[model samples]
Target chain A: MVTFALHGVGVSGGIAIGRAQLVSHATLEVAHYVVPASRVDHEIARLELAIDEVQKELTELHGTMTRSGDLPGEFGAFLDVHWMILNDPTLSEAPKRIITEQRCNAEWALTQQMNVLIDQFEQIEDSYLRERKADVVQVVERVLKRLMGKPGSLPTSVAEERTILVAHDLSPADVIQFKQHHFAAFLTDVGGVTSHTAIVARSLAVPAVVATHNARQMIHDGEMLIVDGTNHVVIVNPDRSVLSEYRLKQSELDLERQKLKRLRGKPAETIDGHRVELHANIELPGDLAQVLESGANGVGLFRSEFLFLNRAGLPTEDEQFEAYRAVAAGLAGKPVTIRTFDLGADKQKAELDGLARVAPNPALGLRAVRFCLAEPKLFLTQLRAILRASHYGKVRLLIPMLASVAEIDATLAMIDQAKESLRERGEPFDEGIEVGGMIEVPAAVLAIGGFLAKLDFLSIGTNDLIQYTLAVDRSDEAVSHLYDPLHPAIIKLIALAIAGANRAKVPIAVCGEMAGEMTLTRVLLGLGLRNFSMHPAQVPTVKQRVLTSDVSAIRPVVERMKRTDSPAKLAALLDKLNA
Target chain B: MQIREIRLRNAKGLHARVAARVVKVAGRFRSRVVITVGERRANARSIMAVLMLAAAMGATVRLETEGPDEQAAIEAMVAVLAAAGDRA
Candidate 1:
């Protein structure tokens, strides 16, 4: 077979060499056939048997998951929903009626009823509820597979040879089942970075390339495949020389991963005995397990906006409280810094009423603390919830995008009001919960003293800090190349914030992409940053960088780096600093 | 036969998981439970039908249950519908 390459988005990073195992897309390939009048009853029986098998399959999967108790609670809930959908009369009874009326095969009859149910789901006004159509489709697909006599489970791999799954798409249920099989990697014809397949792939620490267009059709079963997730490339039926090269690279990656795993139990201390705290930034409470597994000191940033997104109306105080409490209690007394919902500016505004005016420049528009300050009720509800959760464990409140002293005073006042209300209600909370502000705006960095005096701690959000300083929208592809983090002004601002916080004895951390970049680890340490927060997957690699560096030795080079204005010269100095 | 109106108290209203809970609870009883939202009626025991109702938070839905155990079924359905958060 001729060797070829397929390119797509690599949501998970790793390398894998395996044989292709194509997951059948039964929904797309269901065969429709007319049944004779005498065979109508037999067709209806076939549909019933298929539905029964799918129900049994779901039940078995649920039992295995409950016994293992390793999957998230949501997985069990997903299985439950699929089970209910399978048994719903629309799925179970309507299809039989369609088979009797249309005199069609079992698969075709089921697909016809599924389309009708999906059409009804499409009429749902709520976006979140409407997305349930995918569940309906997935459930029908399961029954279709059974009706076609194709078992849904993966074929056991040949001894010692890895198997990679290639499919048009994967439902969350399918991914959950794949977890038990330990597939080497996943290649989907369509999905984005936030797709269920991508999220599960990252958690599994496997190589996955999504949105491969027609990967399901192009690659044949049992074809020799090489998945380079970091580079977002998949090689099929590779030549001998190429196969050997990829095999060598794959082993190197494996060895590096093993080395990182060993560092999980080690402290993030520099060679000169200076200790650095490495924390993880999580978007949801479910990520706490990974944070602990990565050996992070605590959660540095919990973007609470996730609870407020993708739903109609704002999250109620009780709803928000449960989420915050889960993270706080899960940490077992470790610090969990929960940032209040930082909505607006790239976040959907449909949920928040009266904030729908499209700003000329959304980044500079009313967002973050400004948006919260504008809507005091929303802000206070979140504040009350966070305060209530503080009773569980070490919880800190971090305010985002504070550009003025007035915003700081106002936010502090709102928080005080929240506490007073809780006290009146006899609700217990940590009275001395540390409050912090994100130093993202250049103005905030310049006026760092006001923040240092008012807030209990400070965190440098380098992504926004660089964006505001350079006046570039990073998401705009045309001007994204101009967004540089290594600019002299950006470095000076970060250094200033760190120095100010250190002078006042206030805790400081960098919780942005800059903190996770292993190449810039020494640079940050030299600037007196003792705390780093990043994605859990990045902690070990950055900790490895921290383990080898001497902060005192890099200070002079860092000072020189601060003085350098030329980009090329700065790049050279960065190389030398790492060396 | 029993009919009563109950407002949805959950923040997410009748989303998938909540609908599943309703369906599971309704399936336990022999009553034919029908939930009506602004003239859109759905059998509470069918998740697909209940989800298509799309009753948001604070939406006042009419629950009608009729069978030998209609009284107990309506009470249970009311408890699930009036639940706050995901407690149901």
Candidate 2:
């Protein structure tokens, strides 16, 4: 076979060599033909039965998703849409009318009705609306597949085969279903980085190349293919040398991963004897497993917002208490710093009742501490839960987006109130629980002394600090490039915060995207940031960086870089330090 | 017939999720409901029809209902739309 390669967006990073398995788009070739009038009722009944089967399948898929502790809110909504479409009069009633009037088969009749809907969608001016045609197509195809006796499931006989799945397109639901079967990688002719398939692939740590445009057509079944997800390239029928090179590269990666695992129990101390405390920032209670596997020193930032997200209604105090207790107990006595529900901003989904009015710029609007303070009842419930959980383990409360002394005062007052309520109810809680403040806002960094005076410790949230200092919304595509974490002003602010924490004799930790980043770890260590919190997946690699970081030696270099105003010089300095 | 004019409220607009919400709310009442956007009208209860209406974020559309529960239907839809509009 001739050697060739195809390029596409490599969304998820990994490598896999497997036989190609084509997953055809649900598009069916419906034969248009007149049916005998006597068989029309049978045809309609067949269509109804098929629709019933599809609904049952979707409902079961939804049930499976919910039981798996996945985002039922998202998958359930999609399934509900498909179910509604299947039961729609236009699909069921109109198709039956077509079958009787046109004397057509159920498949042909359904196709006729689907075309009418697609035509209407095609006329819509909005591109997003135009995209709904695909959803309609998927639903119609599911019905057609059922009518044709093709179950919407992977062939179990092929489960043992190492194969790369090639599809015209895949919905998020399809991605989840495919995950059950062992596929070497995923290749789709249609999708982007934001597609559900791509997102799932990344989270699953599977190789994926999407938007190949013609992968399903060009790649034949059982053809040997190399899916290089890291480069977004797929080599078809590679030469022996090329295959050997890839084999060598794969082994190297495997060995490197093995070496990193060896660092799990090792302390994140430098060769020069600087002991850096490495911790994990957990978004959900489920993330505790990864934290413990990564052997992080403790849970530095337990984002308590998970209970409020991806679902409707506020969790009761008991629900919150149980979630907190699970995390605290799972940590097995490691210090877990739980940040209160930092609602608003990007977390608009967490606001119960959706009562928070739309803000032109939510990042600067009613968010974090402001939102919690405004919703004191909700705040108190969460506070009481955290306090109760503290009794199980070393739990601390950390307030996010603190800028003013008055906000700190208000939060402390509420904390006291929550404790009083718990005390009045005779609830057991750790009275000696330490409360920390997040120095994210530039103003908070400047006023660190005031915050440190009242709080037990401080965690510098560099994600927001960089954005606030640069006056750029890092998420905004247009101005995102301007968000410089290593800007002179940002470095100065961090140094100032560290200086303030030292003078106040308060422990300081850096917890944000910057904290986990290998490129910035040495610089952070040089700045006297002894405590670091990040995703558990990043722990081992960051620990590796920490082991090599000589704080005593790099401090002077970091000091000089802090004084430099030139962006070019700063970039050069960072390169040297990271090297 | 009871008719009311409302703007799309959901910041992400009348996407699949918002359209699904609209369909669910419209399905609650006994009224025969139709929503008109620009020159196109769609059955309020059909997910496909609602999605096809393509009202988009901040787009003003007319909601028409004619049945026993016309007022209740209109109130529910208008309330949902306004809530969706409130989402950032």
Error of 2 at A496 (Å): 2.5
| Interface RMSD values for all candidates | 4.5, 6.6
- Each prediction's whole-model lDDT (CA): 0.86, 0.82
Best of the candidates, lDDT? 1
Q: Lowest summed lDDT over 10 consecutive residues: which window, candidate 2 chain B? A: B9-18
Off by over 4 Å in 2: A1-67, A70-101, A108-141, A148-150, A153-179, A184-199, A207-250, A304-326, A341-343, A346-358, A375-394, A417-430, A566-579, B1-88
TM-score of each: 0.89, 0.71
Error of 2 at A118 (Å): 9.9
Please report the TM-score between candidate 2 and the true structure.
Answer: 0.71
Model 1's CAPRI class? acceptable
Per-residue lDDT over A1-579 for candidate 1, one digit per residue giving the tens place of the 0 to 100 score: 999999998988889999999888788889989999999999989888888888998999988877755444566777899999888888899888888898998889888888888888888888778988988888888888887877664555663248898988887678668767788899999987766678678767788999999999999988999999999999999999999999999888779878998999999999999999999998766677899999999999998876643344466788788878988999998999999877778754454533466778888998899989998888999999999999999999999999999999999999999999999999999999999999999999888999988999999999999999999988788999999989888888898889889999999999989999999999999999999999898999999999999988999999888887788888888999988
- Report the Cα lDDT for residue A547, model 1: 93
User: Which sections of candidate 1 miss by over 4 Å?
Assistant: A36-39, A60-78, A123-129, A153-161, A305-330, A347-360, A373-385, A424-427, B5-14, B55-60, B75-79, B84-88
Per-residue lDDT for A393 in model 1? 93
Q: What DockQ values do the models have?
A: 0.46, 0.24
Q: Tally clashing residue pairs in candidate 2.
A: 4
Q: What value does DockQ give for candidate 1?
A: 0.46
Q: Is the docking of candidate 2 incorrect, acceptable, medium or high quality?
A: acceptable
